[model samples]
Target: MTEMLVPTELLTGIAEMDGQHDRLFQEMLQVKNALLAVSDDDAHGLALLSRLADDLVRHYAWEEAAARRYGVPFADHAREHARMAAFVQAKIDEIERGVCNIPALMVFMERKFESHVAHFDLQLGLALQAARAARDAA
Candidate 1:
């Protein structure tokens, strides 16, 4: 069994964001498992990768919206999101062309996501919590 990409310590404490993160990791794990299976057909893994990419786009948009709502500075975070999306797409393309190293790509993506959540997403989570508290206190 593959280890979880997002560990407990990396959780943002924001319900929706955490859920989305979990889903993204789960999808990626599924893709990894599919690819590692002893089968010639990689169609299922490819489809999962595509779906993961789409879900990541949606997650990024959700985070941006939350950042705006909570007055969190988002320019850097959005840029990071864009970069990650591009990287994932490029890797998917490489996989299609039979040029990708699946294990290395998975390791890289896991580390990248862990760092992003620990830094950017955690800051956004704090901001969101603060904003909600302020609103409730009014």
Candidate 2:
């Protein structure tokens, strides 16, 4: 059985962030599931990816702003966000060039996304919580 890409646990503990993560997973999983059902269907994959790309931008922007609000100077976190955006854009380019191997890309992305969220996202959530607590105590 293929591993589900969605993070099963609440990594961020922030309701909004957790919800956003679930939304991303749902969007991503939709494309992945489609790819799995119909292999090498570039048009379908591209269409889904195009929609997902827009959603990702909005989600990333929210996280970026949250990082700032939390006052967490986390360069790695920012880098990961940039990396994901660039990766999705690269996939878009590949599809446009008529050379997309979506299965491989899907597997790689899902694994990376799962781990990134389980670790970095969770850490960011903790940092945000700490910041909030400190602010409340102030």
Candidate 3:
């Protein structure tokens, strides 16, 4: 069975972001399952990986846009997203080279992603909420 990539605690009280995160988590799970599968469909696994990578890129971009709209300083967060994108590309490269040992990569992504949500994303949520409150007060 594939492990759940998105934990329930990731809900930041931000509806759109929460939905996007849920979808990203599902996509990650699919990629993980494909990488871990013992089947001979290498092409399928690669395709899944490609799709997951693309989804991740889009997800990050969406989050960055949200951060900007919320008046959150997004430099560090965007940089981290870039780093994660590089990491994903590297993992995809490894897979393409027939090195599908993804247990460590999976662990890294899980830990880093969870941490990002707890810190960066949570900060964005708070900032956005505060902005909304300020607007309402004004």
Query: TM-score winner among the candidates?
Result: 1
Per-residue C-alpha lDDT of model 3 across residues 58-103, encoded as one tens digit per residue: 9899888877776779999899889988988998898788785776
| Clash counts for the predictions, in order | 0, 0, 0
Could you tell me the lDDT of residue 136 within candidate 1? Answer: 96
Give the alpha carbon lDDT tens digit for every residue of 1-138 in model 2: 544334567457788888787777887888888766856655786788888888888987888899887788778888888998899899889878969787888888777778888868888889999999999999
- Give the Cα lDDT of each candidate: 0.89, 0.81, 0.79
**Model 2, residue 137: displacement in angstroms?**
2.6
Highest lDDT, which number? 1
Order by lDDT, highest first: 1, 2, 3
Cα lDDT of candidate 3 equals 0.79
* Candidate 2 lDDT score at position 102: 74
| Model 1 residue 14 distance off true place after TM-score fit, in angstroms | 0.8
Candidate 2's C-alpha runs over 4 A off are: 1-5, 39-41
- Return the lDDT, model 3, position 82: 93
Worst 10 residues of 2 by lDDT: 1-10
